[model samples]
Every structure is written in C-alpha cells, then in structure tokens.
Target: MEEKKFQPYIPADKVVPEFTVFSVILGALLAVLFGGANAYLGLRVGMTVSASIPAAVISMGVIRFIFKRDSILENNMVQTIGSAGESLAAGAIFTMPALFMWAAEGLCDVPSMVEIGLIALCGGVLGIMMMIPLRSALIVKEHGTLGYPEGKACAEVLMAGEEGGAKASTVFWGLGIAAIYKFVADGLKLFPSEVDYTIDAYKGSGFGVDVLPALAGVGYICGPRISSYMFAGSTIAWFVLMPMIALFGSDLVIYPATMSVAELWADGGTWNLWSKFIRYIGAGALAAGGIISLIKSLPMIVRTFVAAFKDYGKGSAGVLRTEQDISMKVVLVVCLAIAVFMWLFPSIPVSFIGALIVLIFGFFFATVSSRMVGLIGSSNNPVSGMAIATLLIATIILKATGSTGASGMVGAIAIGSVICIIAAIAGDTSQDLKTGFLLGATPKKQQYGELIGVCVSAVAIGAILYLLNAAWGFGSEELGAPQAMMMKMVIEGVMGGEMPWALVFTGVFIAVAIEILGLPVLPVAIGIYLPIHLNAGIMLGGLVRLFVEKRKYASEKEKNDSIQSGILYTSGMIAGEGVVGILLAVFAVLNINTDISGIISLGNIGGLAFFAVLLASIIFFCNKGKKAAKN
Candidate 1:
C-alpha cells in the first residue's frame, strides 16, 4: 500500500474554475432536495436520508464533465462548498419541524414564515463563519485522523477525471440507475410499499421497517462492522425484548380477529404504555450514546479549542487564503448585522429576542461542533449533542420564565432547533474545508459555492415542508412516525412537568457500557432507536458482504475484483432504494395509495425474497467484474 502525504492548507494558486461552479450548483440542489425530504420525512417518520456521499458523487460528476481541464484540487474545492448545503439542511430538518408541530397544536403562535426563513438563513451563514476559525486545527493539523470515506472518494473521483479513467463512467452509470429506480418505485409504485411489520410470536410484537433497497444499500456501503452492530441491536429488540414482553406481562390480551397475536396488555390507559416503554428505551440509548461519545472525544475537543484561540489571535489573514478571507473582526461585524436584521424583521414575532438567542447558541455550538468534527470526523459527529443541548437550554429558559405552556414550549423548541441546525452545519463545513485544504482548493471559492447551495436548499426545503403540512397534519396518528411523537414528548414532558428520568438514566448507562466495551456508540444508539425491521434489512446486507469476503479467490487480483463489484452493486441498490423510499413516503402523505399492499403484506416471505435478490445481484456483479478484469 502507498502512503498518502497530508497537507494542512491549499493555497490559492491551485484552484480551477469548473470545480467552483459544479460544487455550488450541486450543493444547492442536494441541500434543497435532501433537506426538504428530511423535513417531510421527519414530520412523517422521524428519520431522514443520509445525503453526504450522494451529494459528493453528484458534485464530482458535474464538475468532471464541465471542466475537463481542471485539476483534482479544483474539483474538490467545488465539492467542499457543495457538500455544505446537505449538512445545513440536515441541521435544519432535524430541529425546525418541532416548531411547526407546536404551532399547529396551539402551543405557540406561529412565527411568520419570513421569520423562520431568516433564522434558517442566518443559521446557515453562522455555521459557515464559525467554522472558519477551526479550519486549520481540524482539517490541517489533524489530517487523516478521521477516516472520511466520502471525502476520499470525492478526491479520488476528481483525480480519476484528471487521469481519464473509467471510474467517472462507473459513477455516472450508478447515478443514472439510482435515479431511474427511484422514479419507478416512487412514481410508478413498481414494488409493493411497506413501512413496517408485525410478528405474532409468543404474544405479539409490532415493528416498523423502511424496507427500501436504498437503506439496505447504505448499510452495505457503511460496511459489515457497523451493519452487524445495527443488526445486533435489532435482534435484541425483536427476538429478545419483544418476546419477553409477550411472554411475561399479566395484562397481555391476544387479538384473535387479525390472525396475529396483538397483545393488549394493561388498561388502554393514559399514554400508549407499550409504545412509550419502547420509546423510553430508545431515548435512553440515544442519550447514553451521545454523552459517551462526547466524553470520549473530550481530549480532541480541548485541542480544537486551544488551536482555535491561537488562530484567532493571529487573525483570519493567515488562517484562510481564499479570496473571501474577511478578517474575524469583519466576519463578527457581518454576523452582528445579520443578527440585527433577523431581530428587527417585523415579519418575525419576537425577531430581535429570537435572533439574539439563536446567535448566542449558534456561536456556542459552532465551537463545540467544530471540535467534535476534529475528534470524531463529520460522519460521526454527535448530533444528539445538539439535540440534547437545545432541549436542556430551551427547557430551562421556558421553565424559569413560567411560560411552560404550549405557546412557550413551541417558541423554545424553535429557538433550540435553529441553534442546533447552525451548529451541525458549522461542524460539517469544517470537515469539508479540511478535504479542500488537502486537495489545494481555494477557500474563497468554496465559501461562495456554499452560499449558492444554501439558497437553493432553503427554498426547496421550505416548499417541501409547506406541501407536507398542507397534505398531512402533524399528529402521530396522521404521520405514523416517531418524530412528532418525540417532539411532543419533549415539550409536554418537560414543559408539562413530567420528565422521564428513569428512561433517560437507562439510556445513559447503556451508552456508557457500550463505549466501555469498545463498541462505536452511534450505530448501537441508532439501532436501539430505530425499528427492528430496518435493522434486520441492514443485517441482511452485512451478511451478504460477509459471505462474499469469506469465499476463496484465486489471487489478490480476484479478491480486489470481487470487492469492487460488490461496491458498485451495493451502491446501486442503496441509491435506488433511497430515492424510491422518499417517493413512497411522499405518496403516503398525499394519501394516494398505489395499492401494492398484496406484495408488501408478504411479510417474512417478502423479506426473504428481498434477501435472495440482493444476494444474487452481488454475486452476479462479482462474476461480471472478474470477467471484465480478465479481459
């Protein structure tokens, strides 16, 4: 294996024009699409698409085609900017919907859309600005510490374009296939659409599954280790935990009419006790995972802070060489001005107060997030940190002011979400900049490109949210997903004077134990938080990879050939499935059922078929690739 040298900074001389253009356009489009989808889905199912690698691929393809003369360094600069939109969108989607739900329920008077827009815009910009100071520390000083696979792939694509290799063709073909699959699944409903499953084992268990080839593909791409852990978590929920619930509880009443054991345990009483129990467990896992990850990364956090201070003292001039290198003082002034604008905008209710709160929290989280990126890399940044921080701060403020009613609660949640989004963006932006620096792309170009992505993303995302709200109301019954439920619980529990301390503690303990056991906390927490069906799908993908690797190949060439084929096939499956999944969710929200219920209702039979198809696809690709290599 060849060792790659690390470069801390990419001087201005190395940047090219096409990289800048492609990155900006791609970033903006992805941000809008992914961000909008996330908001829509989160409100519907409490989950969102992972846009990082997809966005990178799009940027790489567009840049290579348009700027054939550009160097890899130039294309990378574009991707750095382009990738920011998705990060910003993710942040926004994660937190903002709570406000919308709250307002709809009469918890708080709705802030004018203009006010919301401004908060989003400011948060995006603030995230970018805050990341500037930590660029060197995270990207330069600690290069290669984080295994940024997406970043590496993007860089490699740019290099391949320069070298005129077939890789670009493979990526383009992959993208087209993914897009078409999504269209058919989403637009035509070619496959049976099912979101979850129920097993009548022992007593009965209800579980949800996103069963899209895309999600399974994502798991495959994420590789076996992470996938295995997710599967383990799912197994515990379905095989162990649910079965135990079915067997022991005294209140279990079997539902005979449905042919499956639907355990009606306990009085149909206050709170859906069973659902709440599971949620409580998930919440514990989430908190524990986040806190443990944060604690473990504390040293890197300290180092990032120390480096930031030193850089700030030297001024922004030496830190950033891009054309947009405005001094920290200027950046601060611009930020303050934006804050004032956000505050004074008459369309925004409590604009000034809200802007002030957002600014303070944004700055705080930006520092924390940048440090987190330095420590864990962008792919594994503790999003739960932002969520937890927002919840705590907002709860405290609302309680202290005695405005813990629906109105106060919504206002607080909106504020917290805005801050969280900003922080998340800042952390992700810092990571992207690191990639750019190593490839010698100009910082200034990347910054501008990010702004473009933000504009496109914001408008697209806002529209998506509007459509979802207009079509389907934000209640749990209507959405059938846990996002609204989670938000409702957070607001009602803390503001309504009933905190689930026991669950929180359980989650905390679990996170700690897992970390101590030398397991990565994110996958475990996600597995615990997510439904059993989804985890099972992920496990299936991992198993396929495990089998492929286990097979004896004639030589290293054969092994490498097999691995490459697996990557391509798995990538296609994920892309195809994700695109389709999004469309299905959209249709469900629209209440336009394509009625593939028969196919979907195959249950275990359906799962088995999917497993078979995926396995066959991998094997077929491996054989094809081996032949191609021999030729």
Candidate 2:
C-alpha cells in the first residue's frame, strides 16, 4: 500500500524469461479451462470467482517445481493469461445467456457460435485495449490511492513463490477430491446432488442444501459474512416470503402462474411457488442492488474519469523493458478495426447503430470498469447494473428507431453482451496490470498475454455456452443463469411490457429497505434470487470459515497461512467440480445412463453424512499447516 518509493519484486533493470511460448501455451490452457469451468459455475449459482490466485499457484507449481524454472515473471505471465479467461467468462455468462433464454421462449432465434464468439472477441479485446490507456493513471500513479485488493493479494501470493508447492498441492488436492465427489453425487446418481426437506407442519416452508463441492467452495471463498447474508436472503425467500404468498393467495391465481396458489403448492410443493413468484422478487432485489452500487460509485466514477484523461498514456513512453506497453497507436488502430468489423461483419449481428452503441458505450463503461475495480474489487463491480442500464437505454433507442420485435431484442442483447464483456474484461485487465506493476512484469508482454487469453477464450466460450444450453438449457432449475434471466426480464418488460411489475417492485422495495438498514444488498439480493438449497451449501462453507478464523492459533502468520491454504483448496474444488459438471452435461447430452450407480448407492442419509465429512475436511485443512508453519 505504501506506493511512494516503491520497489518491485523484480526490479525494472533486471529481466527474466517472460512471454515465452511455454508461458503462453500454459496460460492459454488455464484460460480456456477456467473459462469453461467458471462458465458452468456462474450459470449455476449466479456468481463467479476470480481465477487469478488459482492460476498463480498452478503456474508456480508447474513452472517452479515441475519444470524447475525460477522465473517469477513467467508465473505472472501465466496468471495474466489464465485469469483473462475467468474475467471474460464472467462477462459473457452475465448477459449472453439472455439470448438463449429468449430463444427458449420463441422470442428470438438461437444465437450462433460465430456470433457469440465475435461478440466475446470484440468485447474482450476492447476491454484490454481500453485499460492500456489507463494503466499509467490508475495502476502506477494511484497505486495506494486505489487498493486493487485482488491484484495486491495476487502479488503477495507470487512473492511467496517458495511456498508454491504446498499451496499448489492444496489446490490440486481440492481439484481431485471435488472431481470425484461431483462425479459420484451428480454423474453416477450415487445420491442426489441436492438434498431437500419439506417441513410438513409449516405448509409453505422447505429447506435444503446443494451438497455440491463448487457451492461450498464459493461459500468458503466469500467467507462467513457475505455467505451468511446470502443464506439469510434465501431464508426470507423460502421461509417468510413463500409462506406469506401461500397463506394469502391460496385460492387466487397469480399473474404469472396459471393455477391457484393452492394448486401450485399441491403440485410441485413450495418450489413451484418459488419458481413462479419468489424468483421475480429476487430479480427485482438484484437489480436494485446493482443500481445502488452504481449510484454510490457515481461521484468516484466521475473522479476516475477526470483523473484518467489528465494522466492518460503517460506510462506508455517508458524505455524500460518492464515499463513498455502495447503501442497506443496500434491499440487505437486495432480498436477501430474491431468496431468496423463488428458493424460490417455478418456473423456478429450488430447493425450500424447497434455497433455505434457498443463502440461508444463499450469504451465508456470499460473506462468506468477499469477504475471501479481498482476502488472495489471485481466481485462488487456492479456489472449487472451496467448491463441492465445498457439494455434499458439500448432497447429504448432501438424501439424508437423502428428496430422492434425479435430482431431488435437480439440486437440489444448483442450490444449488452459486448458491453458487459468489455466492462468485466477491462476490470480484469486493470487488476492484472496492477499485478504486473508490482512484479515489474513487462506491460507489453502482459498485454500480449491478455490478448492471447481473450482470443482463445473467445472461441471457447461460445462452445461452452452452446454445450450447456444444449444440455440443461438456461432458465431451467438445473442451470438457473440468474443474471441472464434478469436481463431477459428487463428486455421483455421494455420491448413488450409484460413483466410482472407487482412482484418485481416488491423485490425492488425489499432491496431498498435492506440498503437503508445498512446491509450489503447485492449478496442478499443474490441469495433471494437463488434457491435455499444452493445458498445453504454456501452457508455451510461460510460457517467453516468462521470456525477456522475464530479458533486459537499459535501465531498470526500460521492463521493467515492456514486461511490462505483453505482458499486455495476451495478454488481448486470449484474448478474441479465445474469441469466434471461440464463432463456430466456431455453425458446428459448423449443420454448416458447412470442408473447403475443409483442401484448400488445410499439415499439422502448418505448424502448428509458425506457432506458432513466434506465440511470437516475443510476445517481440518484450514488447520492442517498451522503446526508446520509454527515449526
């Protein structure tokens, strides 16, 4: 945090191997793998975790221990590329799935592989390019001024490269165990992936846990506070809200549901009620949360804008190898070319006006995103709000210009997808640049690494989207795709005005009330949006973190190390489970049989017991290295 008179781990005057073929290839693989994995995770849970730390640990494990290399910059390069995939995946999943969801309802045709790829590529490239001009302004000049917490943590992780094996091994262990666990529970149907219990006495109440590795992993990574907030939100949805709805509207037919509430409860139990009404409230809460964050960030966003233009491109003039960046001229030319291509390209589906909207709004949002993440990390960047805002504006503009109906909706989604990706990728780019600045990595090489990641992930994200859509389909319970659903709702509401306003406004007011009460609105809003079972899984992880952190330790360093190890392990679990989930999706697509496992497997009780073990293992591993650290 002490930025003045700063000295990087690798001094600018000294250079080591970086941007090599080995780094690019390794990083590219991580990018695609994490992209696919996170795409699965996000679509399922309405959230995604950054791949930076996991990529760093894995890079160090392979580069330092396995390959017997000593270059920290090479590891930096690997994460730079690897993490790009995650950021891009985050962007793509948040909005692109709206297209597919709309298609499901017959409002639009399914988006093509080429179309998704083009939008991803253009958005990703623009994000990285936009941040190029702001590197000097945000990362270098305003180092301590903006915490860039994730970036700083990544740097610290890299600086501890000697401990890479233990850390990386924790990740590998989580990955392996989670892969098997996910396969057993979901793939083979050894037990249900989710276990739910309806309280018979409480007519409309139900509770459950997903019992999947990734949800637990997400909970641990987010820690106790945020996780608890999420759980609480889910509680309100499942317990308070659902019961209230049923109690009042038992005989009445809801606006969205064709049947009476009593019929719905009798049919699918409380879940039917949730699917019909609670989700809309959750969506409303989520939109309000996003807008609140954006509103709170407005003054600072303005300052970030003014400060960026004043000091723009100052870092591009350095002759030092580490200080050099992609030439601004080349970046501009390429950005213009991408804009032109998007407008002129047949597969991308953006009209000239849509293209202009993407170009103008994309760059503006990219600028906002880069600096916003510097102030608040990527997790709290209010991207959904940005997407919602863009959709609202773009849809209105399209409607006014005679671009109505399905075609206009498709165009609007295309525009939103690019902007969302750009904003996300830009935030990620800034974070990676910050990491590089601290490590004295060559900005130019890191920029190239980011671009490499974008190119590969761009092509790969489309396939992943297609595969998931083909399997469970978006908006289905198996793959909720929450943010996309919200975007879809907004678009429909605007283009057609058919949104259930009463339910949506209920959620909106709920968010406002929660915000006024001084709680973090977004996490709670997300909890409201998702099912109780999923949030319960995450809550259990949070409780584990609380138990671990609250316990006595031999020393502060030991506690920190143990917590760090738990995080690394959890990151691995999330990725591992996600990869296997995709594999299962393949199975589902092919109609592969898993009845054999069900024949031999235990029922829900076995699942509860295994989940208990899973929880205990997290506590054990969180305390695993404490004695070693002390010794």
Residue-level lDDT of model 1, residues 1-631, one tens digit each, is 1112444334554434544444455555566666665566655555555454455555555655654434565456545554555566566556666666667776566555555566567677777776665565455555545433334334444444455545444444444555564554445545533444455444435565544555455455556777787666656555565566456643543221111212343233111323455445565666556556556655766676575555556765644344233345656777798778766766443345566777766766676666554443354454544565456556766677665566566656666656766776776676566556545666555665666656665555555555656666556456543544455566667776666665556656766777888887656766665566666666666677677778887777887777666666555454444445555655665667765545544454554565466556666666666666776
TM-score of each: 0.76, 0.78
Score residue 13 of candidate 1 by CA lDDT.
Answer: 47
Please give, for residues 287-316, the per-residue lDDT of candidate 2 as tens digits.
677677666755655675465444344645
lDDT of each: 0.57, 0.80
In model 2, which runs have C-alpha deviations exceeding 4 angstroms? 1-14, 29-72, 82-114, 129-169, 317-393, 423-444, 459-493, 578-596
lDDT of 2 at 85: 92
- lDDT for 133 (candidate 1): 54
True lDDT of residue 204, candidate 1: 39
